[model samples]
Target: MIVESATGRRTPAFDTARLRTAAERSASGVTLPAVLPATALTVSSVTLTLANRAFECALPAYACSPASLPAAMPDTGWAPEGRHGLFVRNHDLYLRARDGNETVRLTSDGAEHFAYGALSGMSLMAVPLMRSQSPRPPFGITWSPDGGQFMSTRFDERKVESFPFVEAVPQDGSWRPKLWQPRIALVGDAERGDVEAAIFDVAKRSKTVIALKDGWRLYGQVFHWSADGRSAYGLVTMAALKAIGLAEIDLATGAVRIVVQEATPKWGRFNAFIYSQPNVRILEASREVLWFSERDGWGQVYFYDLGTGKLKRKLTAGQRTVRDIIGVDEKRRHLFFTAGGTDADPDPYFIRLYSTSLDGGAARLLSPETGVHLASRVPIGNAAPGSATTAALSPDGNWIVESHSALDRPPVAVLRSARDGRVVAVLETADVSRVAASGWRAPTRVKVLSADGKTPLWGTVYFPPNMRQGQKYPVIDAVYGGPQVTNAPADYREAVVTMNPRSRASLAELGFIVVMIDGRGTPGRSKAFNNESYEVFAELELADHVAGIRQLAERFGSFDLDRVGVYGHSFGGYTSARAILAYPDFYKLAVSSAGPHNFQGFYPVEGLFPAADYGDGKNIRPNPAAVPPNYARLDLMPLAPRLKGKLILVYGEMDENALPSVTLQMADALIKANKSFDLMYLPNQTHDFFRTSAYYTQRMWDYFIEHLMREEPPADFWLEIAAPSQTTGY
Candidate 1:
């Protein structure tokens, strides 16, 4: 069968002969799986309907520092009229004001992917240009509270040099062009982006910097706004090399006071960025706030007093890691946060969300339900909570969106009252109706005791879509077991391609049982379970998931453990490799995509390498204690020959996150060990090549057609799907 998207892209299930030929061709000089094979397996792609774009907070949500709970929204991007809205355009700061007329445009220097903000109405912004990779200031634009006053970052980039990338058609069969130049600064050195914002007073129509400082090492202008609009707060970390200074700035006087500082520690340097992603700003505030600090043994949270620049209280005073501050209902006085592991040795593997009173109290365990993977936070209305609640809490704070799955589910998006965590209204259901329409089997959630005997693990079982209950089926354990990331209980669910269920889903669709377990290292369990894999990334968590697989298979007797398979990406890749190499009898087929195989390559930025890698952090959170060398160094290749299971490896050649080198480095060893396996290398793509629906569908289907069910899909099925074409290029 074949499928086509509305844009006319193709996904055709071709003959098995073609698959084998492609596989052999890829084997010539390429190190990884360069070609599809002409075996009985058929592989194709599927477009996914992923809700990646979101305004996130629907209610009165705070934009707190990632480490702490946010109390207020920065004046830069709020829609004044209503409390919530989204930035519809790029490079432009927009806020819904009280008036219903036109939306306010705070900055014109905005470009695609760039952002907008405000220190206050009176203070202007100094922005950096688009595609800028400099250690210079990035002051785009700013606005005041009432939304009347605005200021812009002052800069004259006329003197800076530029590196141009003239787009051209590919003549040969490659994405790399015949002509190329790297490191062309968008803003040149003569005075690399040295410009101050021209202030514009809404009342007087004035233009000037609040306090003029020409070329200081300040580059980032994070969020800042006074609740009353009388004052403004600003945070700037130099964009220059050795970037390690964060402070609370006075928008009026241009005076800088260090709220947090980083210095080289005993053995390493405190050389890392303060927040997670580029635009995640650390806000200033009080109450239910969480702060990230290295002061403790691990990265713990502390209540902060933005007014006094002091640590008012240590919320999570332990050795584990506090991942994100999800939400805080001040009126209710409860804090919502997610963590990976326990107080002793935090594992980066598992994660869970927890709730506690804002006035310092014991945390209420909410997620992980006991597995390595997780259950995400889903809350509904709470205009006010009186007495009764369902699911667990009222819609405002409590709700079990959905449980993690192995084959049948992606992630479930349900509306539940926070008062009792009961289901209210469901915002979205990933093709549930379609699953029923397609005769897909629904899985069940189960609990398995952990190997440690101290904790319990949770897992989801996907049965064959239309198979008899008493019949036995081969089981495939599809999982991703690492820290820093998670496989949601509810995510996208249209088959891997339009025709497959990820490894688990496809197998379930094929009359085989599919299991996905959230072992201790997986997220959404509890602070302790999520962090169990912190220092080490394997076995500790894998043992738990594997145990669940054994228990579940045994209980059902409908499971053919002798034909078990394991598959995953990145950390899951590491798991798959280990399953066949270490626990050969447990898994018969193993497939991995961009596994770390080595941790050295997972090094922090070069700047933070010394301090973070073999090093340290000044104001850094509790360190992982160690960062692995490149994934290749793990050398699963040596054990490949000793494996009793078949193996498949796939990776993107240009993956910045999981470099292709990780896979290539392991190939030499695998070949020397005379290991037999399949490989797929995507050119001109990056790590986690699932950005586009097409990319995701193709990668997913190809692997399954060959290994899981041992059948071939279509070659031109992609061209026939006719899925919705995603918008790109203005």
Candidate 2:
């Protein structure tokens, strides 16, 4: 029920194996299965499409028609009409008819590392981290309006250096470890990968290469067709991470025209770009392009001439940040968007739906009841997962299904009028009465000042159930300090069992006051606030966390600050490990799982971390050779000598994203320093260790209880996934 981006802090799904154990102690007569069904409700409307025809049952015709609505082109090789498929095989592109067996070879030049439809560097890292079933992704293609042609990119990574991943236990049952070498363009590598785009004609069976030089890399770029389909547009970011340009491709000539370009001294990231929401859209009727930019210190929308690339006007201006362009009524010249910091709400992070004219004027608030109002509907066919902010407006752009929730509020989806924000109907309201009766408590939303005592910081606290006034509890900071995303959830899902059932609430149940903070340097705020930790990734923003906890201790007398502990995965893992090392006197213990101790050995994207204000403002440049001294300070190995608290390092032996080697380097450093620490390696597990999540959760729980609380963990209390019995309504 919460709105979050992919780059945000990771939330491990709560394992379902403990459902039986939890249900046994609940006072309410509610089963886990019963609660799940009640939370699955959406709008009472469904679209059934058969034989190229669609019917919207119990809904208006505008709800399901594509001709009347502006539909975004899918970033795949599938034809618009679904009559044929374009795919890559054996490093070359191919075309095949859906109803017939007629096949045509498009290109035969693709080979090895220079393959057609080769995954981007991010995708290459994501597949291993996600442990996807398919080793390859679909060909990223955008079909034309007529379905006669499509555009795609061919990846060139032959010049990129290769990194080996040796399988300790091969799936083929081989006695020796199998090695896999993937071409990863690490920072300082002279020859990084590039992408060459092409448009393929279905009938002519020919391809025309795009004529763009430089500024074209594989990651953070996807093509989309203009409203009229005569041209294709894409948001392109340079490899150096300092410039971004909106390029328009002429289908007939294959010439790329830069429509609008923006450069920054600091790193520029398309933080809002996704397949469902591309942050850039074309208004074909007016020959105007809608672009999202943060040049004004806040994310806002701007209008530009598509042909001349000249700024027409600023559609939005203020300290508020525009989260997404949810929908546009081109005929009416109105734009519907979601934004934060626009209203006078207690929590600045509370997002609300807004509408403003494309011609420019004051924006009118739509959902004004406070909290985070997400103007998104459940995605239908082939839509992206968690793509709630895109394609939610009904056809003709009159109605929107908005899901609203906050830290203490259960999610409720309602249908609202797009023209004037009026609630038409209440679609669903989550029933948490049973959960409340079962001793479930809502977390307290706490606001504190940053370490500087100037900027405000927000977070949440989960206390032990049935707490007494005079009792004190050990504090545990559940953190994710990655600059990419915030750690705290703004919705009622704080206690929901997602992937693994272990949550801050579950930890608090074990006699600790759990805290989740979205400290400084996280997104969803002003640009200055986000850049607080730039070039200081290794610092972990521990100063802000300490300041926040001290303020919370003064407000809540039940928090035992002396017995503080911290735990996180991925970047949070890096933070937790750094916390114990940087503030050993304050933090008693930490469980750092899969921390990127050394960024050089990690993903190639580390090149974007360094930013120095060379006076002109262009701070970020990918020059690893010039920053060897900076790397020395950023590396965690040198800080191992300062470790004084109990530290537990966990990693999946087969994790390819952070690589188990990174964790081993930390362990080796600690061993060389003659320090005592604990290490747990899960065999045959990937980055997330999905297969062994329950075991990992149990061990994490035990670590905090045994070390922080000074209590004995149950002897071999294994949380197992029990087989369903005949009476069990699973």
Candidate 3:
């Protein structure tokens, strides 16, 4: 029998017809009963929900199959607002009225090479060095509070380099591949052009361009239009993002003034995880501004007098880090924010809501519970308590909509009094009866020391069902050692497999323990702790992982130190392969999918590659000689010969994030080094294996089962399900 798998891969199932034919023949030439086949076997269908979607799977009476699921969809395209909004069409910006009666084209020069909004159509398969000529639009446009005028950045990349990738199409019953080249601008490329801030007068139908001084560039989308629509504020950094400065732009004359600028020796590069985005807010009535900085070694909010261009005071000061600003009550001189690492909380990663005054007074913790608190302020002057609301601010600024949860407790939405931090009314409580009935156990949170022996590292462990005393189990280290994302869950019900529990839990069912660790260089801690990977990405990052595993094994008796496997996607994928290669004797198995193994050969952008401050303090430029060595240390190609365990590599042919070539390069290097490994390439799939994730999942399961368990998977084991009918809503 043939069955369609979740990734649409057809697999062979048990041949029921042959079984029935064999039952008809008897050894004594006597006719066997038709019920003989049914005596010991029962065929049924089970509808299982994987990744929040339902799939019908066929299984025998006593066995269950793991359902393979697809990856989450990417958030792209335009998001509209109210009656009028701006969007990109055919690479140009267009403003459309909700009634469909009026439409205006804001940009006409937009083209494939030079488009408005972020650049598109470039395949990640191409080499990044050759794609530097590709012109990209501003991160996005900032609309004024009144929506009359908007501020955007125009990226000029006509002088940048170009690269090409082949687009394959099937025509006339034959495969045809066409070459397409796109121009991209690289961070350190000398030919990369400049970006200018442009303000479009919607009513006046005119545009004003604000020019920056020489040797300066706009950092991401740091500019924002004022509420009164008279000026714009943006952060300007040197080309390499070493020295950062905040500036106020004059709308009338296109003049610019530096409000605040700081140069730090530790300004290695612009990493979203390690550093907060430039959050600048303007108060229309007071002409004051709130800006985020880490100058004092911790993320804090600072108030500045815009008129005088001088600092008023730091609104928040503590060992804790300010996460984000929720809402500002200018009338009451109050500001609400989210922070982590509170001194009173046992879990430093648990984020809480806090309220502070504009005059630099003490900050009051609004939700002081020992859990992750997500708070939203209700619209001022419309606060109605005891209503079934997701999030709302009180009219008097006394209450807020708070959703609280911990590692053990499910989420509960409640209306809490801001003054006393008391839950006034419970709006919603999560029902965990279904979870309990399913026999699913929450992973136990574990704490371990970093390689430094002083800093703390957090992780979670999932044990196999029906554990026996003194029995060791093979451990699978599900790693995502990306500096940008933290893998360990902080809130209640925030499991690593929350979206796809069966995907990870199935590994545990297969008789292996699973673990996720957020080691050093990961975000959500203090700035200094996260800077461990600054210029040293590979060694320091991997040291933490190795130390965490060893520490956990020493503490937990059930962890089998001899048998270990590691796996992850993208950045995690890079780490997985590096783990086995770097520590061949420890990690016995690895499955790395879509990893940028050859980091230096691809992109030299700010986040992709690290830069150092030479202390010249005048103009910081990328030193080509300094980057190659760092890349050499992290590149897996040189270490391919160190592979001493079972390893499988996977890549999507159409991957636009980490190009397929990056993975293929490692394969080529492994061949040259004569190293044994496995490789899989899925066609027509992008960075996320939305259509082929199930195929790879099964492959990974088989690899670990055969290599680590020393047992063979079923001859025709098939995990079948249907493709997602629609894109994921999230």
Candidate 4:
């Protein structure tokens, strides 16, 4: 296979054998031990033996799989009171006995496009990298406290439009290229399909569909099931995606009642409290429900009488928004959560933990540290420190495991008393000496004003290892400025750079300073700050990035503004391409891999304007005037003629997240415009790059070295990655 350029010329052939050898050599030197759980497990008064182990691993194997490849069902823990657990394998729900003896299939009609517990295709790509550690529960299932049944959704998308992708064939005749159809429901498509709530009774081996009102779409997974197993609760939004409300469904009659509804005409949609997950809980014993809402322009907690469907009171209120509900202690009448922009700290996005009571009094700060805190619920008897200095309350509500870290320090796990936020014991601390010895430099935290010139934006600067104080170095902007996530690391665990092939540190090792900045329109900030790009998605983000770059260059003399390169995956890919096309004089080179460039072309439904204007009504019909002009301005095809930088476009032939057609469309426009650029199509690869990350990393480094630095990279160079050992058990 040859790399194609717009000029109808082929670049030098890449030597895969030599590249693999170099990668192996590089992987062998990274002997840092794999991270282990800080606390030990104790079951039935038996303390299990635990040990720390390390293994070398190459890129994850999942990246090279075909587009239609099925992933193994994640292990869902056993039911609340029963010996059976639920899992989905090959689209069918199954009940497996804990003893490994009895296994029963629950649904036989479950198919690829239509299945129980299936999420929207658009949401599938937005799943975070961290969540990939465990298989996602099918369509977000919610099991009853009694374990008699479970509530989930059955998605019927058989009528939805399907996009086809061609799988790659091996050159040596080892495999053959095949066409794979991935079903996707575009926003404006004629057949958008439907999703219904389903309740499964384990004992009776029965299933019931609680049909929702017509012209509405399910918002998230089933929130919770009533204690008596007679009702299930969930959230739903209008077909136009404008108004949103909570609903309670009677199990026996399948009757639905809307508890609360909120709408925003300005934005044309109800403000989603949190992205990606349902942030609601049921206070079963009290007959009250705790739900998250942003009706007051800030995300906060609210209490509602479940029986009467009446608002009791707002549990949390202020300029700050609750980021997440960490845990709910019904017995103690306490609610633990994480909030941002509440503290007096300089960084408004730094998340801190807070706790309040069911009666809604003053909330007590649990984590007073000045960094981003991510808290979770600790197991009943486990005493290990939580993952970060973030607080994780124990089931009893008296203890919290605090995992603390900063920009310059690795995580130190400690046990703390929940009542007064006092440290009780140190469980473990990260050993980063090996990483330090490997010449990895901790990024310098930097704060710069946003393009508005008042709002502060946070970022990090990674310098070359052998840097000279007086010398200037070319810089590369490592961006993932997607609305869903902030690229900057707010904790120490993330600050510790490793030799991973996908990290910014590894890229910085190639003789260039790498920087990451989280500008306006990203999450973890105020609602207004995050909404800056609501309608002007493309322009706002790119402007902030440019402002950050200029600010960084002003603050530090090491950054060479004249020679700048940018690269990112997925959303970042879109940003990188826009960076060069929109600001041709600033960015000299860019690598956009799997970018959804032609947003209007690939998913026209998403491209529709007045975002809330949808459904079967004259007033809701698409208005071209309402559509953001940035959509066209950001599109690579329309801007192809304006391309003035050295751009290398990469795409996985089977990338389901950002379909390959988007990239092909951009290339086609570039070719038609008679512009010179390079293109690469990886066969059978997915969005994450997985096994192929090393190869792309090498290509990116070589591209920068050859163009930005005007230096020739070693011919047939390869990087060796350590493969995880099969013998070690953690």
Candidate 5:
């Protein structure tokens, strides 16, 4: 099994003099005459760096004229021709030219909260709560193909309620608490955030607002532009998120037209957290559209007439679920996509690539490997017109590049013919010999029956590197029982398992057995599997985890069932806390971080759960005054009295996603029950408190070592966070 290992090379720390010397020795024949005295080197009207100690040639045309503009946003609002950079400051849009230091104000009517080209939405939930300066929001604008004009969304959140937050321990070293009130919409609030689309012409310096349906707002931008450049397209969804429509807007008239609309009995999803996208592709040349849906129990592709918005045919079928659209060769009428649940593979979660005709035909396999094949269609020139996470296909659409891996295997990149699933060449195989030599071992793949005793569950088992054969170790269940994603990594990646501080691998290093199971409700399977926990948040696949653990104890002699502990964050945090309360005899201890123990306080707008209980009127049931019975069943506060195992609650004081109140409420309940538990609040941190993760991880190690292992930890053992290294450098 191939495994990836670090290149083990440090970036050369070059000072200004070294940089200047390197630039002088460049192959471009650059010398002291051309090299500027400043750190930056402008060669051939482009910014070049001598950091690599090499003068690279044949760069992209855009690279020849990099923007030297002082910008507010990172990686957004750049002209299609790379001639200008766009940014929002003081709620107004400004353009900075690439060739010269010419800056122009694009809009003037923007006010404090009524802003143009502002990035504000459910996406930045933690912006208001954090103690740090509010980051400059991106100008949520889309550039025209010709780089003459751009379209942007206006953010109007002035009417939304200002949620109060206090920096108890001010970062600025203030004596008193600093109060901050940011416009944040809560459940049952009458006024929430709103958005509208508008076009800004560069030459004329004029703006035209698009006539959209009331209550409809654009999130990002009009992602697609027509071939004629006269129109653009974007997704439109209501507050309920139960339906989604592809709308086309005329550039000149600013008139909107619905290209196609799809709704589900359950709420439709535009994006599921960060794991997936809408998975919609518009074929403008052919006047056709390809969309993904789980209507047939599995995610399948369908064809529709773009102009008529009528279903033409179902392009894909069966139990296999289409994960992503890789590429489309319009001239040849070929479509490539990634999918899981092939009948031949024992593991249903293994993703594979398939190619078929856009006119509808049997899908031809493109990656026949017996593992997860991650096919990518990277953006090259004008070939693949999708984002990095959206789609990837070769320029010619003749070859498919995929990295294949399994639980115990590393990655092996292969190039296959797009016409057929033939492995034309083996590009690279990860070398883990160095890691192996250092006594590192691959995780063991484990499978067992779920709580139902019929469905199969997959997971991985991590053992201590120096484990003795005769002695059993204490088991720790590294769980994130959220339905949105699976915790178990399908391949070998440090972030997923091997070297992540919070991963099971790291836990196993402390002389404990670590296991991660993807229970019934997690995604990457059939719709039936994902819907298992639809309205029932309390269940959270804990029973399935219990069953998996019980089965593991019966099969292997290495796991100690009596000393099992559970740990997770966010939704996983709720599950980890719930594990001890529900299955006290199974999970002896639990560490929960940023768990929204009560559903009444916070609810995601993803539409996976009922939104009406919180005040949304467009859902299945709308009851704003009283806690809905469905939400009542999800509250862990009432279950606090049932806790018999050791529990510790962790939270970031400034977290907005899980709310500080949820953790405090759980603590209050435990106290009312006269229960003894540990509580910790991270100062000045938000939902993703990655900076102080090492300290928390060390505390977790101490807690597990003391409670589960029944041993004393070293006195104040400081687990210092590793300094920035080339291995994980930005």
Candidate 6:
């Protein structure tokens, strides 16, 4: 049943009439939405570096020239391209002139190739020692500190592995079988081989090999350099079955040294916090190596001295994951960052700007731990109140880049004085301008007691556009449950749901509620809270989720638990699959997309273990043989059949991460057990279907609506499940 506030009353909730009009409105006026969670998970599309304005975004052109970027762009890599712009254009390298008008073509063949950072930008334009007649596509590129040199990886084909998957036909296209095999995702023999890292000297306009030792050499990946660019450091493993080594290459002296080996995880007493986002999200942090490592039991800030070729010093300690490396005030020997510790009452949304010595010492939380997440460094010059938290330090340590926002406030970018942390020039104002026309609904902050009331968990509910105070509606709980990730929306501009355009419409048009929460086990809280279910990953995570649902069920009378369905992808998928089986009565239906039916299947060849971080290379590990006598375990696949609700199991045929093979294993078990489940399979898609955001989204939304909204089995359900949908794009 749908509920609304009193007519003609001043209310923050969206009325039915207004919502209907919104759904009826065309999709254009809507803000052009984000297509996918950034593939550059480890880093963002744009980075704010020491150059102050030397922000880098992926370029699209092969012929990138310095004259292509905006004049206001900051200088980075020491040497500025003509216009000081860094970008990836058309999978190639192109430099936006300083004037930001004309673009210089850097490389000729990037059409089918993909290169990530700036070194690739300058390399495209940098004169090559020898350009192959049949040019190879660029893979990865890194520029030297001075910008005159760059390191690039050309992964030559002829020796790699590739896999293919199925696809679905679009509603507008005639049904036909289509094949999709995304490169780098599932490489075939034709695309096989290894990578080569070559340094290109822009000043000399020449290419030189730093190191070429290998069978299947993997260079160019972990790119790090000595402060002066006379030497470079990286971790490389041989092409052998299992390779491991940290090598230091002397550029000027042409010497090589092995500093470390077997860098990947092995049996050890180490701490690990895994997240889907690739790079460390901590920003505005720097000083002596400017990085963090989890090698120790804690994820701490570490300053490595390349000149000495050793860990310079342990920066920050304790259980906190040095969440964000804010900025390093080198002159003051201070590194600014954000993290959650035992110091806060609730989760420390307002991460304190911690200042510590580069050589490791006592750390202090700078922010009061009040606000939610923050934007990158604020601009320098302006002095807005509370602007200190958003301030970013300049290259010379004289100015700062300023930015700010709150859960309900949109971010504004302006310059602020570093000394006083005051705002200067305003670059952007509140941008909710688009969603504002149609009243915006802030997520209701609610606290629900855990099954063990001692641990208080929190969640947010975004009542549809215009929701009433005490309303009952169908809610879509978008679950993440992964310890390192949070599904809760933190800032105003960054919405809980990123746009796929095609699917969002159907989601709201079909009339359903959406919800996301970060229950216990999620990162950023005190270490103990984050460790509640240590050895067991999903059990407590989902329990907290179910508890939140029950609390909402009681607090908001209209929410129909009978119609509730759980869903997620990867870990999210793992969570949803478990939700249905673990709390059979709490969830009525489930839609697990690209889920793993069993952990053993995806476990590395080393085999399954209790936790990735468990074990001491010498012996003390959670080996199964020494299993505790009484352990409450969650067996999803075997237990799925016991669920008394509609179930849809989706998989991408070519998934490499949560290999489809294991999911298929579960499908077989479900069939033999005679349990009812809906299956939707994608073709040529990897476990990270993150690249194909559009279709996966539409199908997911439609699947939810078809099952949850319509609440009925489809007549063609078996037919759709019989074969792959034909129109999928890679």
> Which ten residues in a row are the worst by lDDT in model 3?
381-390
Q: lDDT for every model?
A: 0.47, 0.70, 0.66, 0.66, 0.71, 0.50
lDDT tens digits by residue: candidate 5, 50-107? 4333332222222222223343346336787877878777778888776677889888
Q: Write the per-residue lDDT of candidate 2 for residues 1-730, one digit (tens) a residue.
A: 2222222223323322333233323313433343322222224433333322333322222232211212222322557677776766787877876666677888989888777776654354533533344544355565675577777776688887776666677666778976666676654456667778788778888788878766554333334565454677766766556777788878778888888888855567655322235556777668888888889887888989988999999998788888877877787888888888532468867888998998989999889876888765333443322222245676566777788987778889877788888877776788878667757777888888878887788887888887899888899988777776666766675434422213577787878998877777777887666767667763636788888898898888888888999988877778889899888898999999878887655655432476333234433335643434445566788789999989999998667666778899899999999999999988666777532477888889899999999999999698764344531222
| Pairs with backbone N, CA or C atoms under 3 Å apart (clashes), candidate 5 | 376-392, 377-392, 377-393
**CA shift at 370, candidate 2, in angstroms?**
1.6
* Model 2 quality (TM-score): 0.83
Better lDDT candidate (1, 5)? 5
State which candidate, 1 or 5, has the greater TM-score: 5
Candidate structures ordered by lDDT, highest first: 5, 2, 4, 3, 6, 1
Q: What is the lDDT of residue 74 in candidate 5?
A: 61
Per-residue accuracy of model 6 over 373-482 as CA lDDT, tens digit each: 34364423322111122345555554444355555667665554444444445555766665555455555656677766667666666555554676666656667666
- True-structure RMSD, every candidate: 16.6, 9.2, 14.3, 12.5, 5.9, 13.3
In terms of lDDT, the best-performing candidate is 5
Model 2 spans with C-alpha error above 4 angstroms: 1-77, 120-137, 172-175, 214-222, 227-229, 272-276, 342-344, 377-390, 432-439, 494-502, 538-540, 606-608, 611-627, 690-692, 721-730
Per TM-score, what order, best first? 5, 2, 4, 3, 6, 1
Model 5 global lDDT (CA atoms, 0 to 1): 0.71
Residues 1-730 of candidate 3 have per-residue lDDT tens digits of 2322112233434444444343333122434343322322224554334333333334543233334443332222222234566666676777766555577887887765555664423334433323335433234576664567667765556666664444454222457764545554332445655465677777776678777786666665534556456777777776455567777888776777877766655553232244443345666578787777777767788898888879999999888877766666677888777888643457777888888989878999788677888765332222211111214455456667668887777888776665666767676787777666767677778888878888777777778999999999999988777666677776765662343212456788789988877777767777676667656554676777779888888887888989999887887778889999999999999988878886654545454345523344311235653335444677788899999999999887656676677898899999999999999877555665722467777877888899988899887888754556432221
The clash count for each model shown is: 174, 11, 12, 20, 3, 94
Candidates 1 and 6: which is better by lDDT? 6
Worst 10 residues of 1 by lDDT: 57-66
* Candidate 4 TM-score, true structure as reference: 0.80
